[model samples]
Target chain A: MPDSNTNVIEIRNLTKSYGKNRGVIDVSLEIKEGDIFGFIGPNGAGKSTTIRSMLGFLKIDSGSISILGMDSVKDHTEILKHVGYMPSEAWFYGDMRVSEVIKYAADVRGLDCSEEARKLCERLKVDTHKKIKELSLGNRKKVSIVCAMQHKPKLFIFDEPTGGLDPLMQKRFFELINEYVAEGATCLLSTHVLSEVNKYCKNAAIMREGRLTMLDSPKIDDETFLSFYDDEG
Target chain B: MKTILTKELKLNLKNFLIWSLVVGGMGFVCILLYQSMETEMADMADAFSNMGAFSDAFGMSTLSIASLKGFFATEVGTVHGLGSAMFASILAIGILSKEEEQHSAEFLLSLPVSRKKVITAKGLCVLIMLVAFTAICTLLYCLAFLIMGEGIEASLFIAYMLRVLLMNIEIAGICFSVSAFSGKNRMGTGIGIALMFYVFDLMGRVVPDLKDYLFIGPFSFANASEIMSEIEPKDSSFIVGIILTVLGVATAYWIYDKRDISS
Candidate 1:
């Protein structure tokens, strides 16, 4: 009984903890369909924690989490089918070739990895035959991005997706996201790049110390922000 | 689960080869022990009457080098069985956390599969590896036995090999459960399980009162180790070991399905 126009992600009073250390607390937000959502937070601000919980990778201490209108914990399999995730600290089999790693992921998802992998590799201009151990960090990030996007997921969730990329590649990455959004795909990105946030995200949520400080459209007070960045450049 | 099992089987085949070589190496060493025992046949005959002290000291009293079946039961087969158990332990400890180590956990878990499905797949992989390792060791031992002209009962030998497989499965469950609860302490979990296994064996030997409580041991079939040596056929511990193994796997699944995967 899901509404067709329901939000892609809905979190209400979600809480998580590790022993006595707090991970995330009292976090509530709703990301609508086709929204390019930017999750802006400092280190240990529970950005990754919230993302993990929504993917059913972490247990909730309290509150509710849903993805594509399905309960994250109870309906995880159904929801994950539509979501493509890119983690901040991505790793692959060092002995495996990039192509093989992508194929392995595609095999797990029951998708045609070869065609999609080739297409993504072409788009990213990344060589897929190199062993993961031989690749630099930025190259590795590119591999992860290609793999995440290959399946044409309805919801794309990226955590520090472009941390190691150069300016040119970063720009290309945004272009890819923008293309997806234009095709009506929903995205949630977590990053420290406020400049990217200014350019890419129409809506953003800022967090501090495991709490939500603001959730609003970047279009708000744009004149003031624009003046600051324009003068600095 | 099928995908996980196939991948695990392929990955561990290399490890299984290494352990099989180690077990074969033990057989080579046993040939030296046998040659020396033959040279000292008179002294060994006198020593044989004092079985209790020898069993207590080396657990080798019941083995007879003169007979091929006993030679295998004591030398090559025993080592192969123990080596297979260690191999199973390593796989169980390494598989789940290895994904995290390689940073593949994020990619793997992101599939259209639930956390429960992922754990189920990993558990299945561990079992498949254990079974495949055990089978390869048994085949190698049988081939060696034929070459050595060891005329052991095929049925009894098969039973013995099956016993090793079950014991290995039980140990794998123990190690896997430890691995599942472990976040950053994966190596610690492996070492802890192995240490506890040895400590339990030591306690069973040192304290006569604890002999009946072998259930407390990390491994259920150390008493069966005595049986493998032909010292005593204590069959009561087998059921307890199997039951505990089931419980351990269930607990591992419960914990893994709910716990967060952190790098």
Candidate 2:
């Protein structure tokens, strides 16, 4: 772990609930600058809930979340300016062309991402001229990836970013993320795929049923981790 | 906000155009029919004057069917008012919920903009579209009167149109507030609210005792036929409408800011 002073994200007793069921319960974790933190969880494991609360997308029941030393709820707009987010499902205005969607995203962030977007599109083999509705799921994911990374934000929050990509594309996605981390950027990658986490992450947090069950290193073998997960179940 | 507004306007351009054309076309056809029926309107008015229950039920009690404005108010205006209310409610309901329904809320809320800014921008877009639809319909009304070799008093025309516009805005405000509170069921909730208000208005007209409580429905305050015939609008209903609108929009902003976005 990095020093406490360099913590990019600090969560203290974060709690959220949907009706009577708990969405997240007293979940707290810290990530320092430049750390590749993996948030591993199965479906309904509260991974998305935690990330969304951090991003100010969902109103939490109680506790605090600070990003880049700024209160997540009070300074959400300012905090988001320095962060890049890619959601699991890539959905956009179906009527717009891929290029228009990217341009709109860039415009919203007040950035000129044309060049970077073009390069990413070329690398990912995405067709910019095609309408978003016509693109395959994998291609739409590529568009979302380009939109997220084009701005080169200080922090990246990716939720199941490689769900629709092929093996080759997934490799390239990891390469892009690794390069970003090498530039002293922090990443919070939420996914259930343990192989990718083993290959890319230095630290990992596993969640189960709205609780953080394990927070450790990915140095443990896949079989051992799966066995531990099974024993918990 | 500008980015979101532009995208929203572009997405709903087709919808706005369709609603405007439908209302305008109906008005135009009614005006043309009025030109041919002008000779018989005196007799028609005499016949309708005795049907108190029917006239009150349809809000044709005060309008003189012999005049072009009165006839338009009684027939075309009533239909257009209902249509406008439905259209405005749908627009308000769809503004925010479409993102969630399409599974695009995650991508949108993740942007650098605040939730307040997003909702404000969406509200602005809906307002602009409603104003555009009203303008188009007003221009068509003017053109239709001109073609029939008749003209409406400028002040009267403005007053009538303003009443319609205000009613639409009030309906939109209530529906938008409901939409903000609802999740995926926003459209249904909005429609239900609109239907409830309309039913209340109709019941108030049919029952004498409930007439005093007409302030509860937006339709009671801005009846086109009443406005066209009267010199001044009823102040109590006007004040009630303004209050409802302000309360609705303010409540929407408050709830949307605090609500959890589960999708």
Candidate 3:
């Protein structure tokens, strides 16, 4: 029942809550195969909530989610095998060297990503010899990027991936993403950066306070990007 | 499963070594000291037995300290039982929760592995460490006995160690359930649970009204004095402990798999 050309990610009336946190309510969206879908929303606008729910991190109160044309909860193991997720703040074993961490991730997925991992380290300027505790925030981000990207997954889900990156590194990060897209990978980029959305995302969903303000807002320029970014869409 | 198992085993090695050394070393030192205290122990055993409620609580009233077996049953047995239980509690209580406490669950669960497999791997770590701790401590005790020029009753010693292992497994299983329910490290609470069980067993031995309900706590079947004396452990307590351990592990899987994991 797994359809390779079906919607890469789909959510229908998803709802979740945690105490007073503004958990996503009735959030729904779909990303087609090979689409660079931007999930643009401010902090606490349910971007991470929706994303986490899709990955089966948070249990939804109602509604459903499916990934790669399979039930998200029922087929979670299968879905994750083809998806590469980079969280907002990546935490790794501090005692391990960067190379060991990469190998550990690869080992978990039963993957041999040595060559790809080496290339990603070089592209991201990651120092493989240093322990994770010794790295700066930007360097840690680079390591997480390699862990998520080295597998060359069919779907890439990055939640605020550029937070600690320098401007140059951020540009290079997009370059890598673009290269992956060219290789037939679908991506879901969750960020509040309007410029990244306008520059890269052909179609984006804007969220405000746990609600989707704009569903699949087509390509827009700087002015319209600002309006949609400000919740004026 | 292999990946998580290897990673957890590697991460937990230092901790396991430290705890094993502390408990096993103390037991070894205590056993070595007993050879020098042999004459005094024969005289003081009477006073200890007469200590009334305190002696009853520690099983000293029933098992004299005049002989090596009695001394081991009353002293070294207490050390191993309480030490291993605490170790099992602390180890299992944090294995799953530490991922969230360290903010690594988001990274770990995001991988291709399922939550069930992750918890199973951690549970296996707790079980393996408990076994290793028991083996090391048992070996240290045997060495101590050799140094003291005493021969242990092999069957009794083996039975005691097996009982201790079962008790630790039960304690660890209970705490494993707690770890799944609590997203944060609760070492203090785990230690508290171990101590509470100790007190329950202690009180159950000293207080007649509580004796019948000893089956509720793990120590009832693991009473060092009873095991050394070849007295059959309360059958009800043994059966209940096994049932609870099964239920505890089952509950852990149910709760951890169903509950939402926060970043």
Best model number under DockQ: 3
How many pairs of residues in model 3 come into backbone collision?
0
**Candidates ranked by DockQ:** 3, 2, 1
Name the candidate that leads on lDDT.
3
Model 2: lDDT equals 0.84
Model 1 lDDT per residue over A121-220, tens place: 8878898879889998899999888878888788999999998888888888888888877777889999877677777886888777788755546543
In model 1, residue pairs whose N, Cα or C atoms come closer than 3 Å (at least 3 residues apart or on different chains), thus clashing, are none
Candidate closer to the true structure by lDDT (higher is better), 2 or 3 = 3
Show model 3 residue runs off by greater than 4 Å. A1-6, A19-22, A215-233
Model 2, DockQ value?
0.78
**What is candidate 1's CAPRI-style docking category based on DockQ?**
medium
Evaluated at residue B46, the lDDT of candidate 1 is 41
| Candidate 1 C-alpha lDDT tens digits along B1-263 | 45655666666677767876676556555644554465565456446535664444234455544544545554555466556666777778876767766677777787786666777877887776667666666666566555655446776667676767777778788777777777543755665665566566656654678767765553445433354554543456677676768887887888887778875
lDDT of 2 at B157: 73
Q: Candidate 3: lDDT of A72?
A: 89
What i-RMS does every model get?
1.5, 1.0, 0.8
Q: Taking the candidates in order, what DockQ does each have?
A: 0.65, 0.78, 0.82
Q: How high is the lDDT of residue A117 in model 1?
A: 71
Q: Write the per-residue lDDT of candidate 3 for residues A1-233, one digit (tens) a residue.
A: 22335787788999888977669889888778878888876678788999899898998899999888889889998888888899888888888899988999999999999999999999889999999989888888899999999898989999999998999999999999999988888889988787888789867888778887555455666676566557555
